[model samples]
Target chain A: MLIWRKTMEMIPGGTLITATPEEGRQLAMTMARKSIGAIQPEAEVRKALPPKYANSPDSLTAAAQVVALEFATIAAANKYWRKNS
Target chain B: MLIWRKTMEMIPGGTLITATPEEGRQLAMTMARKSIGAIQPEAEVRKALPPKYANSPDSLTAAAQVVALEFATIAAANKYWRKNS
Candidate 1:
């Protein structure tokens, strides 16, 4: 969470979004249409885990991977937006 | 700095304040006057160190201390703000 926030701050005017994975997919689609894709879905990643497994080490590792993927995807989107917008 | 953002998010509408130590001291004093004391001085902490020493491990360690102290101070102020605000 801390690293995610730091990474978010590096980008300007980044509004953090928290949503379910379904909502995330939807929002990502919407942002894609507008060429604005910098959503940080840490909330969805955590929510998708079972309650009993939420704070387990495996869950934490999985969450890290989710965040990393989001960062890369968002970075690519921003690069595209920069070139086109 | 990342820890600071997560800590700030724990509180609502906390726009991070990045300022010089002198400015920080003044702002802390002003916030103190308003009975708002949750100002993180990591910027000031980093600036106060010599430029050559900025990226050294010691500087990083020092910055971490400043952030920790700020967290403790802000948490206390928030406790007070919660009680009084």
Candidate 2:
């Protein structure tokens, strides 16, 4: 039995989405579309998506936590020494 | 002078925030608030956020790219293994 959780909330407007892992993923894919470093094309990567899917849910969640921290740290760094850097 | 960029767009609503490095850090900090594995009590960790802040912009940007791809891959995974996992 999968329990859907509220993972991300949109800014500007305070709307939120609560999703099962499967549903959460679909939503993530939609948000990431065509962003910088985005995947080239879904049609091109169609083969890659299937076999490797669902290999490790816990690991992925853990990885997201780490990455989020790292990104936050980096964003924090951009604050200093503007005139010097 | 810092160049601002569009990093994320809120879902369910297409609104976006364009931010310079300093500004972006503030935004990221706000979103990561109270998230699972989120930093607890910004005051307790205020010291941590300040000293380590703005360490590397290029690296952060690169890290975000890799992290984005990794996240998308994980999201893609949830699409599978409903019956098995």
Candidate 3:
């Protein structure tokens, strides 16, 4: 249940992570490269995952799917707040 | 470069669309089911895509990656505005 913001993904038993649009993009690109400290290896995260995630065929792909929802949730909420756009 | 509410993914050359948080969730879940009219067949959209998308390993996977930024942007922007999250 750890959350830095409403747009964060709970990293199973590890950390709840939040990122800007820019940082998220960078994370997706460099996740396999180890270019950033915030991004963890798929294997490392996978090892400690709850049963729900440990069973996925690809953790990175599953993570991307889960993370995308947070992004869309923010996008939709703002659209409601702004009213016109 | 087609966009909707600064929180939408460009559907190659189709329409600019926006949705609520709930609607986005529905779109993601029933995307393969044809449960809603707005969700299109992946193959149909694939046919109309630009050269960049026509070459992807999986357009749906690629799309989830792109759409996430808009969600994160809205999430981050609101966080900046709220200042206490």
**Weakest ten-residue segment in model 3 chain B by summed lDDT:** B29-38
Q: Say which prediction, candidate 1 or candidate 3, comes out ahead on TM-score.
A: 3
Model 2 regions more than 4 Å off: A1-19, A22-85, B1-43, B58-66, B74-85
Query: Per-residue lDDT for B1-85 in model 3, tens only?
Result: 3322321333322322222332232223223122212334345554565544322223334344433444344334334222222
| lDDT (tens digit, per residue) of candidate 1 on B1-85 | 3322223333333532422222222232233322222334355654565544322223223333233234224333333122221
Tens digit of per-residue lDDT, candidate 2, span A2-65: 3333334322122223223222322333333222123233344444555322222232234334
DockQ of each: 0.02, 0.03, 0.04
Predicted complex 1: CAPRI docking category? incorrect
lDDT of 3 by residue, A3-84 (tens): 0111222222111123344543443343212211112223453344356633555745745563555534443433333433
Q: Please give, for residues B1-85, the per-residue lDDT of candidate 2 as tens digits.
A: 0011233332112111212333333333333232212212233333444443236565355445444433333222222224434
DockQ of 3: 0.04
Candidate 3: residue pairs that collide: A71-B71
Can you tell me which runs of candidate 3 are displaced by over 4 Å? A1-85, B1-57, B80-85
Q: Write the per-residue lDDT of candidate 1 for residues A1-85, one digit (tens) a residue.
A: 0111122222222321323344334433332211111122244543553566445676455434334433333333233234333
lDDT leaderboard ranking: 3, 1, 2
Residue A84 Cα positional deviation in candidate 3, in Å, after optimal superposition: 36
RMSD of each: 17.3, 19.6, 14.4
